[model samples]
Target chain A: MIEARHLSKLYSRGVYALRDLNLTIAKGEFLFLTGPSGAGKSTLLRLLLREELPSEGEVTVAGRNLSVLSSQEVQAYRRSLGFVFQDFRLIPRMSVFQNVAFVMRVLGVPVPVQQRRTFQMLKWVGLQHRMNALPDELSGGEQQRIAIARALVNEPQLVLADEPTGNLDPDLSLEIMNLLREINARGTTVVVATHDRELIRRVGRRAVTLDHGRITEVG
Target chain B: MAALRYAVEEAVASLWRGRRSAVLSIGTIAVALFVLGAFLVLTVNLERLAADWSQAAELSVFLADEVGADQQRAIEEALATGPVVASRAFVSQSDALARFKQMFSDLAASADALDANPLPASYEVRLQPGVTGEAVEELASRLRQVPGVADVRYDRQWLDRLLAAVALIRRIGFALGALLTVAAGLTVGNVVRLALHARRDEIVIMQLVGAPTAYVRGPFIVEGVLQGGLGALVALLALGVAFWATQAPYLVPLAAALNMTAVAFLPFITAIYLMLGGMLVGCLGGILATRSESR
Candidate 1:
């Protein structure tokens, strides 16, 4: 579950990355957050992730107070969410297995469990064959798959993606979205932010649209 | 403990994953630590040597050849009553001759070549505890003015000069230690920074996922400690080699000159402290550099 109430984020030089936004994502729901460039989609997700706190608001995600949790507690809260990035922020020097196993490693899962879980997740993402391959050795789509495997390794309650298919072709984008949908079907809440109208129309999930720092539409 | 172990594994694996970067960083740490260790070895030994010289020191004053057995007894009586003299030993001409011959075997034949009693009789005087440098000098002068005395040689001057040099070296060693410590810290910290930079996107993602700052920072600290530990190991190995490599060139003859009962390498205490200090520099550097970089 995620909720933001009348949140406003302002920066120096009168920049409001987001303004007066109110939204709630229910448990186990799959939704797309949509907007054009500079439309505050990333800012809203950042607030939800507690990476950047709202200048004035209350945000609650996964039953934790995002606005009031200490930095440490915020990090704990982050561990509950699986996150995908537009650029597939995998450590290039690390093996595909190492990249995916990172979250569990930090959580200090036992080696057998880590190997089992990472191996299984890579298989689910259709990347088991590239487990030993480095991120650079994989294609853009495969790299994104590794990132997705990393996100899901901990079995987080919610998954957030800021443009999950930004770098993929239409076919690859559809494939990645289907993977996300499959994850959603398994009872993990999914929220993706994207500017791709064609992809959004193709999937036809609940969509929240933003315009000039405010939530303008939700369907 | 499991958390720390995981942190270490993550750190080491992450660092080793970037092989060239890890080697370069660790090499920088090792080089700095080696220099520090070498200086530490010299400083510790110099301290011990100074103490050895002080403990063994005494002033030997030779008596004139014409002085009778009675005057010699009188001078002994005078030195016996002096408060500044803690202890005294009278070496007769025969005893002095025997000791001189024994000390320098190459010069033994040269001693027998002399027709007269070339090695004179002498009194070896040890000064009382708390006798100042000035006290030793003035006492030696007083002894030289005695009726049976020919010339007095305290060798306190030599002691004073050696102590001064030791003090200077100790000062220089401390300064060098500070400089080297800073250099080591910076080198390790910068290495951590480089590792973090190379993994910048990974860090960003970690932060994004609600990974706690500590979790995000844990691996880097682990890497730092590993670098420091390896540096210490390298330094210790180098010290072992240095000890053996110089055994024939420096230790054997020096040990012979001192008439040491047993020769030894660098003290174990010095080695332990060197390794600990080097490792500390590394761990501290990692924490500091990552803190700044992550922020």
Candidate 2:
């Protein structure tokens, strides 16, 4: 459901984040982007999310060109995908329920439907008991679970997680990884970027490795 | 409907979350609107006073003592046909003396000391509506040329000064009101900007989640409107209290002299205009705050 052709992102002073990278991921595929710091893994994911423009390439996701979409069209296009930040990025002042329900609210869903789906998603993520709890009150693993529920509440076709387990312990990381796997198994395309090779080895997923702005390995 | 509810809920929540800043914004708006309201009240009353003075204006053409009845009749006939005269009344010496006595009731002994009637028989000429300045002067000049007329007099200098004062007040009031309006709008804009800065992370998350621009902007705009509206309400209350405290001893007599109703001097329309002005200022502020996409 994603395609990139000769994608190259350049920073100031002649530094390249991604250099002439061509990549594709089929629908409902679970893909891991493994790389060290400054290896362009995050840059590639940002390109897919259309959060940044490439210096010398084009990206198409689900048949829509990211570079050409108008601002309004970009927003509408982004609604079809979900993003999970490494820090979990939950609104600090809101409850877990509010954080998850926020996506549906943005979609203009009715309050009753929002309540129902938010509760159901929280239950699926084992956060139903802590729905009314604030983000600061939750453990790192629990917060990540809330973030996952938020990403999945809208039932988006694709999910992009950038270092989703970066702040958690080894056990919590595995738990979050397994949750992402289950989400992928449910017919959602999942792309995760992480430098954690042991976690990648444990999950046994198809992996693409980037080094020095180039794809070094794929398996 | 669902979107509107959410927007309102978010707006209210935002206000509650940032109550300190909200209070500061509201206070600033209130002070600005209070200045505007004071200017409006003063201008309206000044205008009423000017109109009252203008309506009472009349030209008095004094007849010469040696002129005969025939000459006097001819002058009165000319006055009746004059274009500027809306109406004219012939006041004889006795009638003029009676009016003077009534005006200075405490001077009865002084008035009785006079051997003969000192007042002149005159034509009290009421000009048509809107006759003023050079128009009145021209009409007075024409009256002086008529037979049996000794002098033509009207309180033109005082009227000119009053009208000039009114015009000056209106001009200054307009300028100050405009300045305060702009300041109020900018204050609201600054407040919204600060609120946006406070919620920067939340905004980023919202953008990442594909929240439309309108969805993010709606609540801020609504918050601005609430601030402006509450500020205007406070200003109106301040104005009302000011008017009440000063009315009986000050504005009542002043308004009475101007032939106006003291309580109605500030019309209902002024209040409506003030509220709408506040709302418009808020909307402008909201637009300015959200104009940039840098965030």
Clashing residue pairs found in predicted model 2: none
Q: Which residue pairs does candidate 1 place in steric collision?
A: A78-B210
lDDT of 2 by residue, B1-295 (tens): 6666767788788888888888877887888888888887887877776676677778889998778988987788777745578888989998988899899988867877999888898888887756768878877787788888999998866878987987888788778878877888888888877877888888888888888887878778877888888888888999899989998998888777767765344588889888888877887787688665334
Error of 2 at B257 (Å): 5.1
For candidate 2, the TM-score is 0.95
How much lDDT does each candidate structure score? Answer: 0.82, 0.86
DockQ of each: 0.53, 0.78
Instruction: For candidate 1, report its TM-score.
Output: 0.81
What docking grade applies to model 2?
A: medium
Q: How would you encode candidate 1's per-residue C-alpha lDDT over A38-82 as one tens digit per residue? A: 999998888877778789888888668788888778778888888
Question: For each prediction, how big is the interface RMSD?
Answer: 1.9, 1.1
- The sequence of per-residue lDDT tens digits that candidate 1 reaches over residues B1-295 is 6667767877877777776766766676677767766666666666666566666668788999889878887788767745578789989899999998898999999889988878778889876644557878887787777788998887667768867887787677677767867787888898889888877887887776666556778778878888888888887798779878988898778867865433455578877877787778888999998989967
Scored by lDDT, the top model is 2
